[model samples]
Target: MSIGNVSAVLVHGAWADGSSWSKVVERLKAHGINAVAAPLPLTSLHDDVAALNRTLERIEGPVVLAGHAYAGAVIGSTRADSVKALVYVAALAPAEGETVGDVFYRGEAHPLAPKLSPDQHGLIWLPEEAFAAAFAQNATAQELTVLGAVQRPISVSCIGEPVERPLWTDRPSWFLSAEQDRMISPDTQHFMAQRMNARVHSHQVDHTPIVTAPDVVTDVIVEAVQAVSTR
Candidate 1:
């Protein structure tokens, strides 16, 4: 199975946009694979999924959808037939009838994890300090600066809604568990991966490994792409 015709749609998580997958996009391209960073509005779960589907619609063939952090729930909610496999990168995977918050808070929080609250606009912004302290502690200082500058606050409604049966149950799935993630506990990642029966690839990375450890992130995504291609 030649993967030359396949595409990889990389989705970003809350508090970030499409550019978050820049490193992974470049890495995937180097492997002779086509990858696109799907921009998510961070407005609400519905809006994010719509945005992701829109991107998926533009691609010409089968897709290996990869989502990071909060985008995990977004990818899982998608019902697109073109999406053949799912790759969860330190992401949250809420089951049918479960809200994103339910899975995100499944276990104890990391001491360094920021205390988040919605503002008057009902949007939750990751504190600037959290970019380095927790979100991506392993990222370079320059990377942290860019991450903070381009962050998009997520609306409270995004995490409150329950998802339908996730696509993970219908397709082959892979998970990259960020072992040292400060935002999402490693235990929670493992729990979700096991629940979905996804192939787990655990690594000692931070919450935002797409920026801090692009290689690790791309490795899992490429693995999913290959699996989809062979199928």
Candidate 2:
């Protein structure tokens, strides 16, 4: 199921670094797919998009840009012509002229979802306990520990600012609606997926499925990549 010349560029969401995609990366590699996790600064939307572009610029040929959680916004911001498809894994999809927070907080959040606020430094950090309670309750204790330890605080500015026209409108897209996601509600996922007319693959997975359910995450990504290759 290898797609020749097409590679994958994975972008992690807030509170997570590139390492969050480690499991998926290994699986993609085993399938002979060139996959790399693009590191986001979590500084601001502009900065995060810049970092994503930096990664895309380095990769040759077509790419399947897959984003997790908050990174859905980052992936859609890229104007790179090489991007042939977009994949959202329990990700947020903010429409044109809308801020990430707009869609993120559209519906009611899960009862267990942590109450988040920026600290004095204006950086929003997920509570450590939220890693297990909300982010990936299905994840093992060790997985939760590592997720919290390597967490990166996202800037308040990241979600507040309105995004430019999203690239998803111009490309084929696949959405993984994590039915059991606590961070982003399933209703919200269905709303975004339907609005975008994306091919939806709903699964009973947690928010951080890239860690808790790597195979499920990779399955959607590979489907998008294969779609792009055939095009």
RMSD of each: 0.7, 1.1
Q: Which ten residues in a row have the lowest lDDT in candidate 2?
A: 1-10
Model 2: how far residue 47 lies from native, Å: 0.7
Give the C-alpha lDDT of model 2: 0.93
Model 2: residues with Cα > 4 Å off, grouped in runs: none
Per-residue lDDT of candidate 2, residues 142-200 (tens digit): 89889989999999999998999999999999999999989999999999999999999
| Structural similarity to truth (TM-score) of each candidate | 0.98, 0.98
Candidate 1: 10-residue stretch with minimal lDDT:
1-10
Candidate 2: TM-score?
Answer: 0.98
Among all candidates shown, the one with the greatest lDDT: 2
**lDDT, each prediction:** 0.92, 0.93
The residue pairs found clashing in candidate 1 are: none
lDDT of 2 at 133: 91
| Residue-wise C-alpha lDDT for candidate 1, range 73-188, written one tens digit per residue | 99999999999999999999999999999998889998999999999999999998999899999988899889999999999999999999999999999999999999999999
